[model samples]
Target: MRIAIVGGGISGLVAAYRLRTRLGADADIVVLDRAERLGGILYTGDVGGEPLDLGAEAFVGRRPEVPALLGELGLTDQLVTPAGRRPLVWAGGAAHPLPPRTLMGIPSDAETMRGLVDDDTLDRIAAEPDRALTWYPDGDQDVYSLVADRFGAQVAERSVDPLLGGVYAGSSRSIGVRAALPGLAAALDAGAPSLTHAVAAALPPPSDAPVFGGIRDGYRVLLDALADAAAARFVTATPATRLARASRGWVLDPLGLVDAVVLATPAPVTARLLRYVAPKAADAAAGIELSSSVVVALSLPQDTALPDNSGILVATGESLRAKAFTLSSRKWPHLAERETALVRASFGKFGDEAALSWSDADLIAAATEDLATVTGAVIDPVEAIVQRWPGGLAQYAVGHVDRIAEIESATAELDGIELAGAYLHGVGVPACVASGETAARRIAESLSAPAKS
Candidate 1:
């Protein structure tokens, strides 16, 4: 009845909680984490005498996982939405409204990209439908390649990179077409004549529902609830050194024998752990690269003359160190009540880990300077907090879908062993939650099945 869950991030926590529910109080579940605290990247820190998320502050509201989980936990009261302000893209040394009717910054028509890209690029976009397209049904390529070749490089770098950079902490050049924009990929695979037409087909239908949701007190509220409900033995500051098969089930290092084990860790760590048991899966995981990022939260005077927009996304080749700035006070109504305005400046991306080495003071200085540069506001911070996430995000590079398939197929026969993490299907909180719950359900079903005669 003993189960060992490795990695204490949201994925591992969700797995443990689901396991407790499926097996009841009698089942012994142990959650192990190398960090002193749980919740993985979903960390909430104190700033200006209040809670603020240092990692991911929000989730896609249209996705049912997060909102549904809150309801089940009776924490729906903590749910909150944005103030409905659109973000601006910082390009050509100025701010412009984010183009509408685009799929991840790929505009459906040339008119939408007006004022953002030059006349030549816009004209190219308008005439793209007449251009012949070559796409294989199952082939994949980087987003930059697809967009830059069809539209001009301006559309890929200025229009698309900002949005893709925010999502993957990587540029369009680093992200793949199929994994990041499946709908667009499908349209191309289905013989769309051009990129413009494919983008139009891929775009979701307009909806009144808010694009994102967040917890009022920060992600800590959700983390605390999951930990309490799981009621598992919490083992912190410990890593699972090795994993091997046992006579009856499996043997997880430090935790000893267990009926089941879930490796809800990052790709690199997961690869290292599965080296012997599932070498193919390990190799596949090892190929999945990671991206690092740093978040610097600054608290300023509430009356600071910042832009009314929710945030500012920096275009590629911008002269600033920050890739984006989330104006917390303007974006979230719950945070507007605070005496000081809140802003989050993000740094680093795939193949760029320089920010991780920056001192807290340096990061704060950069965030302040960059905020001033982007927002045209006075650069004075009442308080600041810096959090570094080394290899926090997994790059869904070209052929990522096939890599995931290889990993999953290789591990399908390993009974009592499961895998879950942000690297699997997606890097978002909702996807991680789904991955953990899936692993838990599989484990529960395997255990509940009758033994062979």
Candidate 2:
């Protein structure tokens, strides 16, 4: 049997790798990528120049799936973590050391972060323990609303938004926190308990958390490792424009034929490709709103005194242009020399993609303004590399889960079609890996069912 996987992102690669590993030489698999690259958004630029991840910086230790995947991929020795002190949360006016016990600024106990705010502010928070979010999982609540309710408006607007903004390149109030941090939602559902207790229970044990980790050469190490293992036919720079069903199984127009297909591309692209063949899948794909973003990697002169040894996160309010700033060199010292700093400035989201069209000069100017606000830095970066990702990221809203359920139901009627990408589940690297593997399993099951019949 022949299996074809579409889109070359990490998800697709994982699907390909897992399928190969599982089926052995039984299945003839081929991965089709329109780009010459294999890692999709996982691209690691300046590989030899100075190792740093332009895409996913570190894998969250909280995710057991990540560690499991690492071992499965034989990347056990490549795990790398921050080399410095605990990370600092930049909020209000200064960088505050992360309190003893906090979950994304929502302290399990109000007293834990007492040093962060005055006693008066803490009093206001204590009066409201329910933190009952007017918003719920029903596409009605947003990141800011949920956090502000469970924590307080001050924490949400001042601190939480920026951290979330850094992740989604979006406004926290509008973002679907239930989608991004479902554990928080689960915590909220726990009755009478503080959001803190709920959070602790919903997530794996805290001790199991990895500070943060990636390959020494960056994420590319995994991508390179996967590519080396793929003995299947590889097709690059070729888009499977149309997927027409053939009696044998399926025919991918101009891109050759296949028995099964794994789509790991963006929603819009996937929607357009499947519109004619799988209208419901296409419609489900179309419902997903897209977001654009740009990451600016500025190489600073060594003399620059960064905010701290640990990286910095700009409260959404703190940065008008640059949503977040990370002192990459500080976060991963090996990425720079004694005299150089690999500082990353990020910009993007629904209303703020204008930064994408700006001339290189304008972008640098705007980013510089953010640099000044977040850090007291006055020196100009000696070199800058700007990367713009147009319509790449997926946005999940309330009712998103339900909508996906409907889409899945509609697509299930088909025998051999499979969908995989960030659109369905969590949008992180490890999560995407899980999605792709799930898709492959679905396809494998569907292909076998006919024989049983």
Candidate 3:
């Protein structure tokens, strides 16, 4: 079978890799990417003679998918957990440690958040049990609204926004609960008495395993491993412009006929390709909004006394332009072994594009200023790299799950085609990997099944 996997991001690459494994030597598989390189946003750059991840740095350790994949690829020894786990939040002109035992910024114990919130807000949160139970209506609701309605606007702004923004580069008011925090959503849907109670009930017991893990060298190693294992034909700087139903299977523009195609591209790109064959699916894909963001990585002098904390998340309404700052050196000890202190500052969120509009110099300056305020240490970055990801994050808005369902239904009518990416399911590396593997297996099954004779 001739198969073409589009996008060449982690999802596409993983899909291609899995397809090769499932179909073995008989499969004619080609991976196509618009860029000259694969790995998409999983980019690593050299800073001060050390490799640093400019894009995603780590994956959640709780998800077995990535770890299992690493084992299979002989990369089990490369996994390294963070040296420090506690991350602070910059709010009220100061940095405060994030409260413990919280489910995605929702504190399990109100008293633990005393330093983060005022007494009045704490009192309101303490009274969560007394508040009237209001079940979410059918369909979807924004995370901010749900949290704010249950636990005051201050909690939503200070806690929920920062955590969600850090993950999706999206606002809590815009991201859907069902899509973004499925566990919390499920607990709520089950009619849990209160937000606190629901979160506590939904959260698993704390474990000794680190929440996140990264590669010892860099994510680049993982990408390189996948590429070597897949051994598929790679077509760089070429994107699947169009998809047409051919007499045999499908024809990808300029790529000729393929028995199957997997779209691992971003939503907008996928939507355009599917417009002709599956218009409804394309429309649904188009509805998925994206957010642009910028990451400024700075290599400070070795003498810089960075905080022991892994990073600092800037709460909404904080007097800082940078959304969050990661003490890369401290978080990843491997980087700390180098003679320089590495830090990464994130700017821009779903609705905020002002930072992205700034020049690289301006953005770096702004990030430096914010970092100084949060860390209380003067920073003189000897080397700096600014990466601008336009439409880097997909905003899973209300009714997103339903819309995805509809998209899948429409696309299912068309044979030998599948959609897979961070846009579908969660945006984490594990989620994307699972999505890719699932797509590959589905395609394999479809091809192996007896045709409608």
Candidate 4:
């Protein structure tokens, strides 16, 4: 069997690796990436002698797949936790620590909310006289509005929206939290009562495994490891322009060719290829618009006095240096220089595209200025690094899941066709890996299914 994997990002790489693990070269595999690089969003750069994460900075503990996979790959020693005390919810000129006993940002006791909580909002949420709940009445609802309705518009506007943009690099108005946060969504639907109470019962206990870990060297280490383990050959810089169906299976040309192709690129690119194969599916795929974001890393002076392990998230109306900044040195000291502080700040989400339009020097200056106001730090950065990812984040709109299911079902009739990437399942790195693994498993199992009887 000859399998062609499209898009050499994390998803494609993982699928190829997993196929090799299960099939042991029973099939010929090749990975094609348009860019000359791997680890699409796992980019890391060196700024002023310090390693900086240009893409995602940290992984949450609740997601165990990442840590477990790292351990399996012999990367146990690379685990590093952000030194920040706790992520803050910045809103209405105040930054409030997430109340204790809350799960998934849902406060167990709404009355305990500080600073930004309002009596009217609390009354609206707590009043259950005319309350009615069902299995998420609508399968398609914006996650932002749901949070705003249940947790107060302040929480949604200040905390949830920015965090979603931070995590997904997209707009929250179109995201469906139920799919993004399935566990919490399920608990809510199960009648745990109140977003706060439901969340407590929803999340499971923590794991002994490091919640999150990257290679001590960097994300490239993991990508390189998987590349070496895959049976698929990799062709970098060979962009597949079009994918046409063949009488035998499928001929992927400069466009795409192969028995089956696993597209792991961004949603828009994926849609373009899928259009010729399945038009309806292409529309669904294209609907998931990707958002662009920019990350700026600054190295502060040695004399800078900063809170130890404290990272701050700016409220919506906060100074517009950028959306948020993480005290890199304080959060992950292992990656920082002792004499100087390192900070990673992000600017540019849906409506904030103009933020990245500025020159690197100006953007860094702006970011530093914002940090000065939030942290009261008075020092110029020694070195600065800025990275921009265009259309990298996937937006999950209403009926997204159904559209995906339909796509999967639509492509099944066409043998040697498989879809694997963040757009299909979850969008996080761990989930990306899982999505790849699952797609590969499906491909492998069908191959061994006794010729479909």
Identify the leading candidate in terms of lDDT. 1
Error (Å) of candidate 4 at residue 185 is 3.2
Lowest lDDT sum, 10 consecutive residues, model 1, at 370-379
Give all candidate RMSDs, comma-separated.
0.8, 3.0, 1.2, 2.9
Best model number under TM-score? 1
| TM-scores vs. true structure, each candidate | 0.99, 0.88, 0.98, 0.89
The global C-alpha lDDT for each of the candidates, from Candidate 1 onward, is 0.94, 0.72, 0.88, 0.71
Give stretches of model 4 more than 4 Å off.
25-27, 118-138, 191-197, 203-212, 255-257, 336-339, 448-453
Question: Where does candidate 2 stray beyond 4 Å?
Answer: 72-74, 89-94, 98-100, 112-121, 130-140, 149-151, 193-205, 336-339, 448-453
Give stretches of model 1 more than 4 Å off: none
Pairs with steric clashes in candidate 1: none
Q: What global local distance difference test value does model 1 have?
A: 0.94
Error of 2 at 123 (Å): 2.9
Question: What order do candidates take by lDDT, descending?
Answer: 1, 3, 2, 4
Q: Candidate order by TM-score, highest to lowest?
A: 1, 3, 4, 2
lDDT string for model 4 (365-450, tens) is 88888777766668588888889877767766667777778777777776667787877787778878887887788777766666
lDDT of 2 at 254: 64
Model 2 lDDT per residue over 86-114, tens place:
65666767877656555555656667657
Query: Which structure is stronger by lDDT: 1 or 3?
Result: 1
For each of the candidates, give the backbone clash count.
Answer: 0, 5, 0, 11
Clashes of 1: 0
TM-score-superior candidate, 3 or 4:
3
